[model samples]
Target: MDVHGTVAPGFEAVRDVFAGIVAHARGGAAFSVVRRGETVVELWGGLADPDAGTPWERNTLCVLFSGTKGVVAAVVAALDVLDPEAPVRAYWPEFTAEATVGQVLSHTAGLPFVDAEHDLLDTAVCAAMLARQSPLWTPGSRVAYHPLTYGYLVAELLRRTTGRGAGALVREVLARPHDLDLHLGTPPELDARVARLVRAPDYRISTFLDDPERRRIVERMYAGLLDSDELVNSARYRRAELAAASATGTALSMATLYDLLAAGHVAQQAALARASRTWSEGVDALNDRPLRFGLGFELADPIGTYGPAEVAFGHSGAGGGRHGAWPQAQLGFSFVTNELRAEDTDTRAATLLATLYDAL
Candidate 1:
């Protein structure tokens, strides 16, 4: 497999590792890294669309899935609206829940899944549903990954405070000024650049679970949500604002965004720090793994999802896409793919991360 891209001096090993992974992988992927705000490696290979015979170009965009949460968290942190201790009702009067903004950011707010059948694009309807629903657990009592509802809550809070939607605010405050290509709500004209997601051949939630009861519970928990891969790749879903999941962009853009946050703009840096601190740590009920979470970002785990640094923080999307920044190393990295895989036990991203850290 031939990879097309460049690596800065002394970073050839990173490129080699990426090339090896793409060479053997079933689908295309892009990996990028930035050090001290300079791009050190930008590489991509394989098929963006195997069926269409499209090569994975540097500009190819892929869905970020939950990785979108990290960008949202950074935006919120930069705004400084999260008071860690203040009740969320303080900002959105309609929100009757007693959870704090920090709790919502930290995934401790119990509104993980909105039970109502309201349209997600209808912010008012979704916000109303969120307001009416009771949390799965007492606010801030435990950590359960809010797979889809997180972005809605964040967007609602932003809408009430900033007089703009989360997607618009993110573009205005971060993407536009930094020239990052990331988007919470992708526009139609850019649709051609988005890559089609190819589901892993052997994905099954039950396969990862050993206990019958646990498998049953996990299956039921996810049964009601919309089919995520299909929804995300659809034109309507891509065009709408699903802030937690629908973000589409290149790996370079995601890495560059992290680079900007790492550059130490007082507010952005402080926000990044707040988001990277371990706000919660325990076995995640959803994935059934010992997980750690900062404000909105997932902290580096023993699983190596965010690489080897205990201080690294970022988000991983549904498939194999991983992006984060290691503040200790002054490095930001992104790995994105069109191949959607089961999150449990998939070590491709982890392997590349280990190689990158070793090379560094």
Candidate 2:
């Protein structure tokens, strides 16, 4: 496969791994790594649009899915306005749950799924549903992933605190100054640069139907839009400010965001330390794995998602998109793709990550 970017000398192995994955991938992906404020690797390959034969350009923006969480979390950490221990109701009076701001960011607040049916695109409706619903468990009592609700709640709190949307904060606080191509609510003019998402040939939704609770959560969060290529590739989805999932950007831009964060260019060191502390740890029913969380970021786990860096912090998207920073290694990187795959079998990002660590 012909990859379209460059890597520093020692990072050739990382490029080889990416090329190997792209050779077999039907869709397109981009992987970039930054070491100590310098870009060590930037590579992209495959079809941005297989049907149209659009090449994945150096700036092709792909949906980051839940990787959006990490970006928004970075923005939240930078703002540093609300107290993490303060109840969310302090900011938004209508917020019923006693869950603290920290609990929501850490995924410990039990407002995982809203009971009533509503358009996820409609932020008002989703926020109202979340505010009305009671926590499945006492706030901060358990660690359950709030796949979509996390963003809605975060957006509301951010709005209440900053008098602006999360996307606005992202643009002002991170994108503009850092020259990043990332966006929580992508504008129409940049539509041409956005890569179209496609499901991999072997893609399959793991509906946890055997367990009623898990089944309900999975269906509510991902039943339609998450699995629908037509919907996700639409302009509406890209334009919506779905911070938990709908971020669109190139791998380099995501990596650059991490680079800045890692260098403390955006948030204070104290704030970053607080956000990186282990706030929650338990079996994540949503992914059916033992997981750890720090604020809005996913901490390094035994599986080595961040390439064996135990103190690494970042978030993974639904289908093989990984973006994070390894403080110990002074590295920030991202592997983003438009192809949706089952995480259990996907090794695209893992292989690239391992190769990157080995090279370092």
Candidate 3:
């Protein structure tokens, strides 16, 4: 568990809070921190596979749902480094919305979901469907978590603009630049290493469906769909580039990414910076009601939305998985695990972060 040495410039309370989560979870995890583009902490503990008894190695990969969206957004940032006038419609004319290229990147596109409800998990089918849909809200008019649609929109836009999937483009752009092991789609060779999601005992769609507005929002967020057990633990999902959610990688890799981002080493894309800067921050009744987002990253507005807001920003995945955030003192702090706890977004992720704020 203590493979990596402890980092300082933090409170003892931070160490205790970290230890507390490790003790509570029953799976393997890795937590790392980088300050000003330098690593200060790299820690791992527990088992990678409780069933097979495999120790959680330093290379263990976890599925970071919405966190992966940040990875995809990084591609746009990379593109923006090269061109600022490039329109989202330039890449995806279908997206020639009132929303500027800046609006889409900022989660203001309002096309939070596919126009209608369907099983968008199948990437190819979903991609085809997305090509023909219209915007949900005027781009930049309001904020709504793009939820499942973010992946389809970004990936398609990337492909249309650059003639390459965001996954491939990301690899050519930032991933390779930083030596990150993150993958938009799971390489077939790594099929065996991917951990099956572990759902909570009481996780049920009925619990969420009983509410009308919650249903509407979730439906729009998920390609106009619903959450399901099948959606959580499927190999088919492994290769998907779920733009807003479903990015797969390790804590170490994600931390490395944030480290670069925090240092303002963001790609030389001016448009990407402007787009990211254009994203709405602060308390929005809808977006922050579930999770607060800024451009491709989640704002660590602890006092307002979920966690601390001392320059902290990153995304958390479904089922207790997480990665990245630049606190006041650090650029990247990662908390990744294979536990796949039932309470993914709000419940446990918030708990882990709250604990981190207290301890760090």
Candidate 4:
């Protein structure tokens, strides 16, 4: 594979690791790193459209899936509008009166899954549906990953507080000022730059099942959610405002956003520190693993996806996208690919992360 990009001096090892990974990837991928606000490495390789034989150009955009969570969280934190301890109902009267913003960000809010019939694009209808439902468990007692509803809740809050769409707020606050190319919804003009995602041949939920009990729990937890790969990759899905997922951008844009946050103003840094603190840690009810989460970011765990640096904070997408920053090392990293694989025990991203850290 011919990797096309550059690395700052003394970072050749990082580029080598990126090249090796891209060489083996079934589809195209991009990797980037920023150290102390400087772009130290940026590289991409492979075929963006494997079927069409299109090259993965520097401008190719890939869906970030749940990695969108980190960006959403950063926008909210930077605005510093909501008091973490305040009840979400205080801001959005449609939400359950007892659930707090902190609980919502930490995934302890009982509103995880929504009705299968709920129209995700209709914000008013979706908000009404969530408002009518009761909590599955007492709010903030246990942790459950809110796969899709998280973005809705947070975006609704933003709408009520800022009188602007979540995407608009994110662009004005983070992307515009930083010159990042990320987007909550891909505009029509940039649609051609989107890469085609290729699902792994053997990928399935059963690949992560340990026993029947865990499988049963996972199935129940994931009920009413859209698990079909076809729906996720559709044009309708890309154009919709699904904040928890559906973010599209290049690896450089993702890395640049994280780098800015990692080296942001005092208030922004303090907000992120509070958000990244250990709000929940233990075996998660939905995923059935020892997962750890801060406000909205997943913390690095011993058996975690983003390596073992405890201070590292970011969110991993369902397939192969990973974005985070290591405050201790002053490093911001992002890995994005069009190859969709089961995320449960995948170590490809982690291997690259470890190699990057070692090179430093």
lDDT for model 2, please.
Answer: 0.86
Q: Candidate 2 — which residues are off by over 4 angstroms?
A: 205-213, 285-287
Q: What ordering of candidates by lDDT runs from best to worst?
A: 2, 4, 1, 3
What's the number of clashes in each of the models? 0, 0, 13, 0
Cα lDDT tens digits, model 4, 273-358, are: 78888887776666666677887888887675777666788888867789998888887899999887776655668878887877
In terms of TM-score, the best-performing candidate is 2
Model 2, span 1-360: residue lDDT tens: 588889999888988888898999888899999887889999999999988999999878899989999999999899898789999999999989889999999998888777787888877689988998898888888887787889999999999998999889889988998899889889999999998889877775552235666776777766376766898999999889987989898888888888888889879999999998899987764646667899999999877777767679999998889999988888789999988888778988888888888888
TM-score of 1: 0.93
> Cα RMSDs of all predictions?
2.2, 1.5, 3.8, 2.2
Report the candidate with higher lDDT, 1 versus 2.
Answer: 2
lDDT for each of the candidates?
0.79, 0.86, 0.62, 0.79
Total colliding residue pairs, candidate 4:
0
Q: Model 3: residues >4 Å from true position, as ranges?
A: 1-15, 81-87, 116-119, 122-125, 203-210, 223-231, 269-278, 281-292, 302-306, 327-330, 342-360
lDDT of 1 by residue, 218-240 (tens): 54444333345566568887877
